[model samples]
Target: MPHPCALDPEQVVEHEYVGLLDPELRERIELWEEELLDAEDASAGPGNYDSYEEYEAAMGGGGPEGDELTYQHDLSIAPGWKVGGFASRHLTDPAPVVCSCGAGMRPLLTVHGREWDSGTLNWVPLEDLDVLRLPGANVPAGVYLGRGLMCVFVCPADPAHPHRLSFQ
Candidate 1:
């Protein structure tokens, strides 16, 4: 369907819309970032440990290695093109994205620069395994939106209502 103001370009106005995030989920994500940062800081240099397993063992084996909390958080919010899914608030804190009609907007589409990154390798489709080994396999499209994702939110109350755009 066409946007509400597709025919009238001037009718579409620019405004800021903040995304909403759960406090508990935000806390968990913060913890995850901290853990990753700690791991990076603890590393002496390349070949500091023979392998990831050795590094984990040296870190007391209590961080993100096979951690349920990390897995759950990562799994809940996926990266890449998607429809009707949770948005990734990796770059900023979440706030509500409200429609002009006063209805809460729902995520309709999300565009990303790449299908998956090092941290999100779990999201890669099994069918793409053969291509995954090739250079630039993760980045099928060269599109880049700063350093994060761009989500388009539509008003559930009325499809004709203008949709909002969010960059996170």
Candidate 2:
């Protein structure tokens, strides 16, 4: 499926590499990636795609109805980590109602389990399996929000102000 929020083909978006992460955090993220890959692979059953194109064709739906997607407020996953989307899971801690700068906080981005899930079938990196499985085994943060999402909030007064983490 076409990404509902995809921009026009001629639109230009710039992205800069965020500096390399600390060794410890980098290792942790690598481990999480490995876990996610394993889960996705295991969910693909016994069959295997011989090439990336085959997998893409089988998992996505950018066929003839590319423009059929309608914009809605509550989608399952937040595409491109965009802001304004609601948290997928229920909140674990809703604190930080106010930022340290004494200003209201706004959602900065949504940390998703997998880049894509079954509903969207937009771009499943690895067979688009059920990545949102139980939060067992080596969870990324030792915090399990089920298949839920984590919303990061930033201070309106100062972007540098410490951010907050709220799980849904």
Candidate 3:
């Protein structure tokens, strides 16, 4: 995939045939699918791994805390376990999960969109953001934020831009 053509925001084309995906992103996504497919066995059973080495490999080795990914820019939205998907916010951004400390946990997609504007949780790369088939959708697993928050879908003028929601 090619980087979004700097000259025109609407350059290239739509998904499938579009060349607007960022080069790094296209590459990383390609790699992630590979990793996901190669997900290895843990050391013990269920959630436990064979050893520290196996554990790290299974979870892709994280920081000193062992978090799979870094948590930043926490926001406030649906907290606790989310039962149903948020009605219309999935397209913009998932409701942010705020920690008791004041900072809101970043949206899961923001974390997925590593190059996101952490402050705003807006994905710098456009392709990975919410995409729709024009009208409505139904995500059975409960379309939600990573930490498990409700989500709603929104449609922007340019589908590439981050969708906005009334909630945080």
Candidate 4:
């Protein structure tokens, strides 16, 4: 057997990492990508002519209704996913939390979630969102505006994973 302190002759030194990422982080990222790809592939239909970018855009409501969808926050996505929307750190009661970056947090004007397991759909107004925190979301992720509604993006852990806090 080789000596405990001595290195194996064929072992690599592990001196070079592509960046700050360690193997575990890399593995998580890979796994997440794999899940996203699988989910996308399975959901895609022949001659659908829709792309994820288009889907993402539609999900954000940037497109007119009836266009290719980006997937609604209440449909294929989980809760707490951050989406592009108007946000401000300072706010009124129940929320008004401070961001880790020291920016004030805004309220979630709106929210959505799809429970694929139960085939349930959800769409909450701003008043109710003062509580729920979804995954992989930043503080801005939770904040919403305009009739107190915000779009829900899928948790980054996996496109199909359960909702997480959007804002940190």
Candidate 5:
């Protein structure tokens, strides 16, 4: 996908956060997390990928860890997960993002620098820090969301349409 026109903070529009759920929401999310952790396998799971040699062993030889260490980011949206938040990138349009199809855009993804910023357990596993910090890892080919929320937006009219990425 192509990047949006390079825009200044003043040039682009903005939006406010409006999805603060009730206190019960946090309890539900915690319950869900516990269930998920219990249901998943010990080794064959997120943030726990075997090496090439281990993969080869799992295929035909004895399965075990290998020299290379591979990891996957934990998808569990921890307690801090919020909705309808501002962009978090150091440099990017704020909000009120618009689509090329002449329609208002909505958020598709909110890429935070950390699963838990502070004052709580770091839900983001240390093993996945590299993936989170790497520029363009979650954004477009050239665009960078910096160390904040890289909120990716999509056209509400059509899901297949191109997306718009912005940082706050």
Candidate 6:
């Protein structure tokens, strides 16, 4: 079926930054990634921790510090190509993508240029682990949109409503 609204191509404004060079922020991100990987590992195998409390006890008993909201946001949004999931706020703070019809929009599609990066290795499929060392393996599709992702949001109130696009 054809989409209800026509999308016009427009130039996207770019912002400059020093990249993820902040030592403290970088450390937090790295720690979060490690924790994710560890949690995945613990849950995947048999005879591992039976509960979150046990897992926390096994590892040191402390949650993320300094910018807890960002850590929680990262956990809420799944990386890579996804449909019908929470939009990632990696580049910007959480904001609602509202429709002109006064309805809240939800993420309909999220396109990612790379399946996994240095900090998101846990997202890689187990079968693809063998090719981790291969160049371009992480980015099967060479579609790079702005910083890395482009999300499309649609209003639940009406499918015919215009979809909103966000880049991060």
Among the numbered candidates, top lDDT falls to 6
Q: 50-154 in candidate 3: lDDT tens per residue?
A: 677876665545333233221121222222222232222433443443444435333222111122222332222354245322221122222344433333333
If the candidates were sorted by their TM-score against the true structure, best first, what order would they fall in?
Answer: 1, 6, 2, 5, 4, 3
Cα misplacement distance, residue 95 of candidate 3 (Å): 13
lDDT by residue (tens digit), candidate 4, 1-168 = 211221112211111122224768667655766676566556554424367677554344323332232222223223332233332211222243344444544333324222111222243324334533453212233334443334333333344443323321
| Candidate that would win on TM-score | 1
RMSD versus native structure for model 3: 18.4
TM-score of 6: 0.57
Q: Compared to the true structure, candidate 2 yields what TM-score?
A: 0.34
Model 5, span 1-168: residue lDDT tens? 435432211112233322233457656655766665555434434433357766555433332212221111122223122344343423433346787788988766665543443322234345445665465433322333454456678788997889987655
Better structure of 4 and 6 per TM-score:
6
TM-score of each: 0.61, 0.34, 0.18, 0.21, 0.33, 0.57
Give the alpha-carbon lDDT of every model.
0.64, 0.46, 0.33, 0.34, 0.45, 0.65
lDDT tens per residue, model 2, 1-168: 222332222212322111223667556655766675566556556657798666655443234222123221112334334455443333333243578767977777765544433334333333223544444211223332445556788887888899887765
Off by over 4 Å in 6: 1-74
Question: Candidate 1, residue 18: CA error in Å?
Answer: 16
* lDDT comparison, 3 vs 5, better candidate: 5
117 Cα displacement, candidate 4 (Å): 30
- Compared with the true structure, the alpha-carbon lDDT of candidate 2 equals 0.46
lDDT of 5: 0.45
